[model samples]
Target: MTAIRDDGSERDRVLANGAVMAAGTVVSRMSGFVRSTLLAAALGAQLHADVFNIANTIPNMLYILLAGGIFNAVLVPQLVRAMRNDPDGGDAYTSRVITLAALFLAVVSVLLVLAAPWVMELLLDSRFSEPALAAQRDSAIDFARYCLPQVFFYGMFVLVGQVLNARGRFGPMMWAPIANNVISVAVLALYLVVFGPAQDVFGAFSADEELLLGLGSTLGIAAQFVILVPYLRSAGFRYRPRFDFRGTGLGHTLRLGVWTVLFVIVNQVAYTVVVRLASSGTASSADGTGYSIYSSTFLIVMVPHSVVTVSLATAILPRLSARAAEDDLPGLSRSLTDTLRSALAVVLPFALLLPVIATDLANVVWGHGAAAAHYELYAPSLALFGAGLAFFTVHYLMLRGFYALERTRTVFWIQCAVGGTNIVAALVLVRATDAEHTSPALVLAYSASYLVGAVISYAVLHRLVGGLRTARLVRFLVRAAIAAGLSTAAAAGTAYLLHRAAGDPHWVVAAVWVVVTTCVDVAVFVALARVLRLGEVTTVVDTILRRVRPRHVPS
Candidate 1:
């Protein structure tokens, strides 16, 4: 009974933490959407948009390539161990880690800036031909030069934010991005007011225009990093730069990080193919599909996963690390299973319903200013991405499981397989389809890669953990799929009727239909879950009720 009570308490704590993180994610994603909408309005989804999108994307790619993957996968377990066993509460170790990361990233950022032109040449599709796209190529390199410095700030932000997470402070990491988005939105808004939106070609961007987009975007990342400093202080962590890394077991951390670094390299190699294909499509035509629209659609599809799955995983990771440290395999397995179920309980329905409302949602979100012209292109990509949402979420959670076990090599190999599949699939699809249709095909490739990865990861993780309640998980997933299918049908039917009544796909009408259809979908899903006695759904409902209902205490 005591053990059971303890388990229940832990579950409650996890859910509460997850709720806080999810709330923060919701706000961050909303602000991020606003930022993207402003960007789409200002730039549109064309050659100009692709130049900025690809250039802006490089800093993040560099961060991941250099240190982001290592920092994320290895820090939690290392920090957890230090917090438990170190005499100075891991303060010195944390300081050393931060100093090392900062120094390395600063050098990397400077070099990347110097090499921006070459980097752009390598990353942009070869089809950008020297003669025809000279101006576009030059503009992309210019943007890359200004944006390359973000690598330092981006790396610092993740390192510091993960430190906070290790200390069981999750809200700051999730909320800090809101500041980034707000600043970006303001910058884009100013651009619209000052220079107006860029059209058709990259030749319109002057030196000042390039500076506004480039430096403004970098400023947001700097702000995001700066905001986390106070949170570290509040968490009782102070940055006293300790260079004495000789004795602190950072070597062990780096050993673990080696595989993580390889994992990211594989993932990025596959993404490089995607970037080339996506950017190449834009170069093929003045007005066509490219990275900007694909990225925008991806952002929308990732909202639920970011808000729910990421929150649950982040909240539960410390606990999983602790259990792994203790070598309590059974406890670790059970906790992971519970967290996965909780995440899927929310994610599955969202994934299924996303396709049903993709068109309406896309129109309402991106159908403004110059962006409305490309709504038809963006919506189908979003729907295709929706189909793979569940697989992506599952794959993400499974990788975290591997991280908890400190099995970075396993993850690296799995990523290799997934990345190889994605690149090959994307290449084949691009060849088979026209430039206009490549976005959805590429999106499908993204999903298929993850579906392969998730299945493999699940099977391997189940064995590593001794058992993952495979039979039970399979049963729950099957039932959830059925429930989600029914919910999607209901949402589609209701949305179709509303569309027919409205007679036009105005933003207002799309907005209303989306809300109504979503409400209907949730109602049907919950009703079916109740009829089926799905324990996961009941657990979530009970948790919500317990949080909302007032409790009476004796005076």
Candidate 2:
């Protein structure tokens, strides 16, 4: 392998690939929001929603706690290396990895299901154990029993997706989640037709409700995993399960995963604290907020990071791995630095606008069915999440750089600082706040944690990669901040006028404000990008124009 110079054609290939994944992510997220809205509408955005949401979320949280860090970050570089260096093109190694992971996930899923009550005890606040809330506690535990089986499916989906990503098939992982969302949407619609909107937002689910909601959630996750199997064949891997995992370089990969597992453990510990705190919000009061409000709004702010940074990072990881393999630290630094700038150019404006359009955005998404009365509850958390998402995008992409170099130990230490901060901050903040303000306080803690993460991740990765051009990165941040800040002001001003014109408006008016404000926001950002000669934004505009407009076809 050779050093990957940041040439125009190479950059275009990365951008084009990133764009394909981004497009898929865009559709998936839209569908996901639809599913979230349906859940909010059907369950209402309080304790009732928290029961289902918490139960459903535990499988994912547990999957990550158990094996997610290994599958997601550590193994990609290993897979890329195996594919390149192994005698039979890594197919044997890949099959063994998959087979072993499948067996592990299956065992863990069953164990989790059996341990459902204990799991709920660990994650739920003391309020759940109160005599008055016994029914709700039982309901949450029952849901956990039904949903714990999703652990197997979630692990397989991500494991399969990461395999595909290593083979340079980036679009499928991004697109496959739409299937889950679709299945969920259908289930939620069926529930609505059968049960209608939620009448008791603070009540426990009936047996029928548990069967439909919990099993339906698991089925969607199963479908998500099933959707990826065909992609394995398409990516030229015909998987025949290889159980011979004793004498290969598998130990090396596991050694790397040890640190990543510790990293994930720290992360999940912090999350468990936050979950318990957030759950206590709605459990302690009838007119209170909780996990559903926090998680859904987080999903909303994560769009920019999920679509832009994740896509870009996934597309570029193989290349970064190659650079590290070649010991081309300078090339790795330059490549990562460039990707960072491109990601921030898109992320910053969206982050800035979240505060500007938080209420409007919340209303458009959650302002229907049972949640309509409480849709406004999402605004403060939505506003606070922007900064966290921004900080996290940096930490996330920086980890890709470390993963490329197999620096999992370094990543673990950085995460310790981050997780330590989150746990302490969340415990303190949640103690001082009322139930209505629970989500926002939790978001503040989240932002502070990732702020520590962003600084340490960048600083550490910068040192490891030789130099990530600190001076250049600082300039990019300043320019992008100016561009995004101005654009947000424009959007905010337009939103103010729209509100003044439509006094005491309906959800429809809020929806309209979101659409119009977004347009004006982007238009202003484009003008500013050009005026400032920001290459990141200008290059994207040029690429878009080149594709959409009539071009000279030189034969």
Work out the TM-score per prediction: 0.96, 0.97
Note the Cα lDDT for every prediction shown: 0.87, 0.90
Error of 2 at 436 (Å): 0.8
Model 2, 30-146: lDDT tens digits are 999999889999999999899889988999999999999999998889999999899888899899999999999999999999999999999888988889889999999999999
Count of residue pairs whose backbone atoms collide, per candidate: 0, 0
Task: Candidate 2: list runs displaced more than 4 Å.
Answer: 1-6, 544-555
RMSD (CA, angstroms), candidate 1: 2.2
The alpha-carbon RMSD values of the candidates against the true structure, listed in the order shown, are 2.2, 1.7
In model 1, which residue pairs have backbone atoms overlapping below 3 Å? none
Model 1 misplaced stretches (Cα beyond 4 Å): 1-6, 201-204, 541-555
